[model samples]
Target: MEKKPSRSTEDRGISRARFLAGAAALGLAGAALPATGAQAAADTRTGRPGRGLTRRGVVYTVGAGETPGTAWDPARMRADIRAVRRDLHADTVDVTGDGVERLTATAAEAAERGLHVWLQPTLGDAPQREILEHLAECGRFAERLRRHGASVELSVGCEFWLFVPGIVPGETAQERIENLQTGTADPEQVQRRLTAFTARAAAVGRSVFDGRLSYAAAQDDEVDWTLFDVVGIDYYSYHQDPADYVRELRRYLRWGKPLAITEFGTCTYAGAPQAGGMGWSVVDYDKDPPEIKGGLVRSEHTQAAYLTDLLAVFESMGLYAAMAFEFLTADAPHLADDPLHDLDMASYAITKPVRDRPGDPASPWHWEPKEAFHALSRRYARAAC
Candidate 1:
């Protein structure tokens, strides 16, 4: 993706900054509530929780799956971390990728920049033993960071039933999801398997990383909250109403843990808020160069509005943290030529990744911030102030 200068917040004219500032102030002024058992232990280790969504963050995937094109260049990785802190006013970052080395390097970069790190090593579809080993290795590295006074947490795994084999009947994630949807995968059995796996993962994490333990659960994942310090959910707003979010989120509070929305954001297109996490399905990969299915309109404002509105909901709900789904998606570059070929429309990233000209040897692929970037910049900057 070709890098470009970002537009200023003043130029974007986003109005949510003041709203966010006021909301944060109100939250801080509210009477302090008694800490839950999980929160109490966390407080003992890391001090009390702040007002609302104190860990403002974005999920930055350094490398995942087979996308070598998205691999992190050390210099570019540092630049992105700096932007998350300086430009977005984000105090936390959820660093996810495949390898231990890549994940550790990225987390260290964010920590060095004074941003809290959620070290999530995403080794999708690997053997259970391999995944456990991966988490243990990453946890050890995170322990080193914590000992050195860096604010860091280790997320053992994310949505393992879909990503990890043996839990479900199918070999691949798509197949497992399909089988589950078709009722071939028994829900009760799946829950039992997930709970058992989470217990083992938590044990491994606790043995190495003493900072904090979390797992990024799917919206419906019935995780055993007793295994974690912070209950993490990858929340996407399929419904627009705040009441809907409140109703759905109330269940998590029963666990008596500080809830963190580890992932939240929609693609850059009209009706993406309704599409939620599946908004990326609009692209037809069967084509030589994949194109959008059809008729979807590109609307940066829709993406911006959805994110800001959800941020308000998270803040009002007093979430411990809410990480926007992503900062950028290098594999899904923006193509200005045609609507059908514009892959950025399906990305949740605040920035539109653009590749260099076809034959330019000196031009490196880079990114330019979208309207959502400016909107979030305003809200997060004001909230921090």
Candidate 2:
């Protein structure tokens, strides 16, 4: 399988001084208690504090089967949610993937576990002519999940200029990624096309789905929030100043709608946090058989610390909701003890998994929990207390 290019919008590599500065900024007190899930704190479209609502959740990446060559197992998925609720103590889940069946099943189980659901069904490299076909699938999924009586928020799509076909100068996201990496794509045209499609998506989305709506945008655009409910941004930290990441983010809150960090997470490696979104790829995908770069070391701590600091930032800013980029990337599994074959070194999952092996017999999960898992559990559990 051809490895896709990086999803990061900027080079997130940070200085050691900055990392230490962030660590200092976050003292023990930040982790001692839960973030102010204040009833008076804003958590809705109007920016008014909803009664007891701070969307604490993880992005449940659709189904277990979807993870590279890992056999599809619905049983494993249900078991995973049980752990998400029990271990992470998350109250919300942004379920994302391709199939309608996978999206609904995950949402249904999450709801049963007493968690709010955010359904994001993708159109995946669909052509300009297939926009309607894309929305139809989304409409069907959103409307059905709405009927389930779950506290659900439907995200129309994410980073459309890159993911959706023919929206940008390139034909596919792979092409657009190349154009973006090389700085050849037209920014103004990308913005115009994105906002235009967004308006149409919001209007059509409102007609089919009888509930609140949102879109996980890439770069900022003039979205017709008048047509939708909440403002969702797929923002990540990759800038020099810690304040800059927040500075760019604060602009979105001005929309006067409840905002969500639709996606965020650091990969597991020694320098992953410092590298930000670009950190996890220690392997050179350019090779025929991708190999983990020599000298790169794995450190669950880097991943954990980054998540802790960012979550604290989110809590301090009083953001309504956020979901880690994913729960697990089973396809990016551990390839024996060799650093070159360590696939987990390339993933963002809080749980480290081995691809071509049976899971641990002692544990119900196929993968072992990384340090980030414990850190996440403490953060969410402390908040609840």
lDDT of 2 by residue, 1-385 (tens): 1235322211322211122222222220011112233332222212332233288778877533422345446888898899899988888888876666676777788878888888876655556547655566767676776786768877887656655665566665555555654568677876688778877777777777888888876444456667668888654454433344455567778779998888777777776655544544465656545567767788789888777666766675678898876687765666556777676876778888754443331223257788888898888887787
What value of lDDT does candidate 1 attain over all alpha carbons? 0.74
TM-score of 2: 0.79
- Would you list the clashing residue pairs of candidate 2? 12-238, 34-383
Per residue, candidate 1 scores C-alpha lDDT tens digits across 1-385 of 1011112212322111111122122221122233334442333233233355778889998664224555577888899999999999899999986788889999999999999999998676678999899999999999999999999999998767766777877765545555665679887887788888889889999999888899988766678888899999877645534445655676778988999998888889999877665576677665656678767999999999888877776776678999997898776778777788888998889999777863232345788999999998988887887
As a whole number from 0 to 100, the lDDT of residue 344 in candidate 1 is 90
Q: What is the TM-score of each candidate against the true structure?
A: 0.84, 0.79
Q: Candidate 1: list runs displaced more than 4 Å.
A: 1-51, 64-68, 358-363
Clashes of each: 8, 2
